[model samples]
Target: MGIIRKTFYTTVLTGASVFGYLGSTTTLISPLPQDDPFWRSRSFARYNVHHNACTQDICVKRIPLDKIRPELLQKEGDLVLEFCRGVWGGLGYKPQRAYLARKYQGPATASQLWTSEQLSKSTYERGTQITDHFEVVEKTPTDIVVRCGDTPRNPNPRDSDGLFVISAEVDKQRNEAVLALKSCFFNSGRKVEGIQGPTPGWMEEAHRWYTRLWMATGAWRVTR
Candidate 1:
């Protein structure tokens, strides 16, 4: 009887955990199937987007401009660069150190390479590698788009075809600016091969939550 009771509770808890996990991930929308011309052409055509887990697929987030005005939106370029420099390392996931490995002056091209190091958050672990092929695929006065992809040194296979598209613009009609981040990656075996296993569904939920926090914090940091 005791064993039966334990099994019942375990089953109940497992079901609850699964339900909670699914509820959290329901809103995560990958950009792969979207009709946006630029995303379709540039990201899809160029990368190995498999639409898997957090690191292996695209997830997007947006935040309102709030007090940020249109005039400030014109500085999107500087804001993005600053976010990469000052904000990315400390994003809510885990705190780490980062530094630029490349430089760019004007609009970047397909060959424009941007590399940076994300030092391990743990005092004992070695730093993780990060790189981006940056290009201003499109830019206008009030809006700009920057595309980023991972490079060879990145440790995770999921990052091999990684892409992050940052788009910023002011919407005068809505009285809010939009800061949208679209991210995707491909492949998945390397990081999980050794002792690690497949990414748990709960971690994806955490990724979605932390991603939103990261975007919100970035928006606040830039406009603050």
Candidate 2:
């Protein structure tokens, strides 16, 4: 009877957890659309070569600009920047930063290392290195692309030096803006016989969940 009661409670908790995750505003797209500009880009093609095992996904949220408060609409660029800033400000990105800080004995807060103006400038510039090993590789008015881990900039990336591409785009159509956070990871040395070229299933699942949480929180921050 005790075992039965425990099993019942576990099932209920699991179901509730799943329900809560599904209730978030974020949605995920896997194997990103083939014809999309991002997928067709030379940079993407380079990272997705035969020697690399790549995994790609996108988390998306839509916001109706008309519904936003007047005070938040002071400047269009500010809103875009706020959304970008909010992405890094969320729980998903914080733990890694905190961990790195503890490991390196460095300042944990962005304020300690960079002023607001400097951070913003670096965030938008190509070739600029940001926190968490992310480097800005591409930028446009509505989009920014960052490469993390072993980037293409390295002439010879190690087999263990996997690479990740993280991008944020705000696509405006009519009165709504679609916010997308696209992520792609490349496991180096796919051709090696015994190489672990693909991301593990469990890690991929965890990444998707965290990304959803991040997108939802970022959207809430920008919209609020």
Candidate 3:
């Protein structure tokens, strides 16, 4: 009787395990279903994007994300708003939400005020355009200057708010975070660390890639 009971328990356990495995596999291994609306819709379909999108990539040549935006991580080539999140309250962005949505989602249209600034984020990202490229210049060991976008000249530049060199410095660095900024005047009393690793999976992968980017090219932009 005891042997039979043990055998029955083992059989039940195995069956449960098999079912559990299959259930988990559906979410992880199963392809986007053919029946799913997106797969067949044709208008739009996308695979999972990295959840934690970074505008700042960390690299050997660059500073860490938390160092720049203590509370958030940014990507390598995102627009000004996302990248500036490393700044205090990120100072938000010069443009409104609708503007950012347009920029981030598809073809970006700049405000009339944005004309004086670099036209494309790529220009700033690759250090291609001399107007907004600052990573190459080192204003000081601590204070780095932005390139020639809008330097204290224009009351309101085309693409940005100010027309001068926005400055920043390494207020502090720790395992919790690496803190720095594009403008020191704004960061009078800010937290040096708050960024934390995202959850596992795409979220984590996104952060890792972001880290890779900044680790490579993040630097202080100085004036010539």
Q: TM-score of each candidate?
A: 0.48, 0.70, 0.20
lDDT tens digits by residue: candidate 2, 127-181? 6655535666666655666666553346354454433333333445556667777
Q: Candidate 3's residue-wise lDDT over 1-224, tens digit each?
A: 99999999999999778556433322221122346332222111111121212122111222344445433333322323233222211112323333534443332322222331332222333222222212222233222234322322332222322111222333245332222222111111122233332133574344333333232222222110
lDDT of 1 by residue, 83-166 (tens): 433224444323322233333222432232222223112111112223333334444342234343443333344433444554
Q: What stretches of model 3 exceed 4 Å from their correct place?
A: 1-108, 112-168, 171-200, 220-224
Among the numbered candidates, top lDDT falls to: 2
2 or 3, which is superior by TM-score?
A: 2
Question: Which pairs clash (backbone N, Cα, C closer than 3 Å) in model 2?
Answer: none
- C-alpha lDDT of candidate 1 relative to the true structure: 0.43
RMSD of each: 11.5, 5.4, 21.4
Model 2 global lDDT (CA atoms, 0 to 1): 0.59
The candidate with the higher TM-score, 1 or 3, is 1
Better of 1 and 2 by lDDT: 2
